[model samples]
Target: MASGCEKGEKVQVGKSDLEEKILETATELFAEHGYVKASVRDIAKLVKGSNSCLYVCFKNKDEILFRIITDVGSDLLNELNKVISKHDDPVECLQDMIFTQILFSIGAAKKMKIYLEEQYQLPPSLKEKALDQHRQLYDLYYNKICEIEKQGLLYQKIDKVVMTFGIFSNINWVYRWLNPIGRLSVEEVALQITDMLLRSVLKNSPLST
Candidate 1:
């Protein structure tokens, strides 16, 4: 019943505290063992609840996976839209988009991992719903690229889809390498990536100014 939770963090959709705990534990297990390998019993064991308790909240493992993916995708879109609304300058918008996404991905690295990796395991109907969320996220970046192109700052030679996915390729896997407690803070890593990405796609790197 929670509409949304925190920015750059897992959004809680579970109705009860126990439901939230199941979601948290399930995300860790799914990210670690994959959706197919991780079972309802595995999740229930981790939550110290019976499988029936899990069934009470979620009909099946697929439902839990669907909820996690939906919540993460929705939270990410909300954060990205906020960045888009906050910045009038296309260059700045693009820069913050990179930062915001990287920040969110790292913060919810496990859920993002499950989202990127295991979402295909979902049944067709649920998969399409999840894919719709992904497409919206994709368009936010694609449209921002168009904005930059309109400003005559984007490098026109690169296909916009390629440009958008290139940025995605750069940021999407940050969860694999980023060390949350390592020398660099999350913001620092996000900024470094933003600078690197902007330098490649923009005619004039905004960081230069």
Candidate 2:
């Protein structure tokens, strides 16, 4: 909505609010038009702020994109940590993790889409930063699965790498076609997927020993 040339309307957006606005606009733009195609001026225009405001909040477009990716990653890790703290049983914790992943994927579908689909658009330096954070996320899930196996709670011996990838691949692909306005609410989709995944990995699963 922001044309590059119009003067930005002055508003009382605080530092945090302005940063959030820039990230939100960047996410939308990056989602609609790939990250390579979206411009800082476009984002500034949409937020009704000058490019200088964005610079105050972030160094550049890449930094904004990196922040979006890391922010979501941090939130996911925090939620996973909370679930782990609340649940002693590995199975319950894993179920909570699955549910949380789906719920977050639905809630931040646009951000997730940009993170997944436009990753290559970032410069090598920024791209590596994103990749490293992504690896950290994978490690979190992999370590959790390994913990369950170490506790002898696993239904069978499973490859932590394969299992982690399978779970993430199953859920992450939902971003490609998930409909937020479809018949099912986000909670319902999360629940359905959680049940499905738990059924596959639970100690008494039909598919397992």
lDDT of each: 0.87, 0.77
What lDDT is obtained when candidate 1 is compared to the true structure? 0.87
Q: Single out the weakest 10-residue window by summed lDDT for candidate 2.
A: 1-10
Model 2 lDDT per residue over 72-168, tens place: 8778778777887898777777888888888888788888887777777778988898899789878877877878888876657566677888889
| Candidate 1 residue runs with Cα over 4 Å from true position | 1-15
Worst lDDT run of 10 residues, candidate 1, spans 2-11
Candidate 2 deviant stretches above 4 angstroms:
1-12, 155-157, 206-209
What lDDT is reached at residue 151 by model 1? 84
Give residue 188's error in model 2 in angstroms.
2.7
For model 2, what is the alpha-carbon lDDT of residue 192? 79
